[model samples]
Target: SAAELLGDPAAYESMSQAANPYGDGRASHRIAEVLLHHFRGKPRPADWGGHA
Candidate 1:
């Protein structure tokens, strides 16, 4: 499978450039803010400035 995929330039490029479904690995930051707000009454930080 790996060799087949690598051999096809178009397929490899398509897969390499595809958008990631998960939002830029900032999920932990949001989760931390939520937990802090819930447990310590701290204000949640401003929205993470990231592309949708």
Candidate 2:
């Protein structure tokens, strides 16, 4: 895989620029949104962190 990526500059660039599927350092925001919605009856955020 490393050699294949090295041999293809476009592939390497695309992989390097791709968004991380794991997260974007906003786990706290998402968690807080869920907790507030559950406990305080606040409206859930549009993002909803991820899928149900």
* Backbone clashes, candidate 2: 0
Local distance difference test, candidate 2: 0.81
Candidate 1: deviation at residue 34, Å?
A: 0.5
What ranges in model 1 sit over 4 Å off? 1-18, 46-52
Model 2 root-mean-square deviation: 4.9
- Superposed on all Cα atoms, model 1 deviates from the true structure by an RMSD in Å of 3.9
- CA shift of 27, model 1, Å: 0.3
Candidate 1 clash pair list: none
lDDT of 2 by residue, 1-52 (tens): 9997999999999988878877677889888998999999999777643522
lDDT top scorer: 2
State residue 38's C-alpha deviation in candidate 1, in Å: 0.5
Q: Tens-digit lDDT track for model 1 on 1-52?
A: 7896779998888877777877667788789998999899999777776753
TM-scores for every candidate against the unseen true structure: 0.47, 0.48
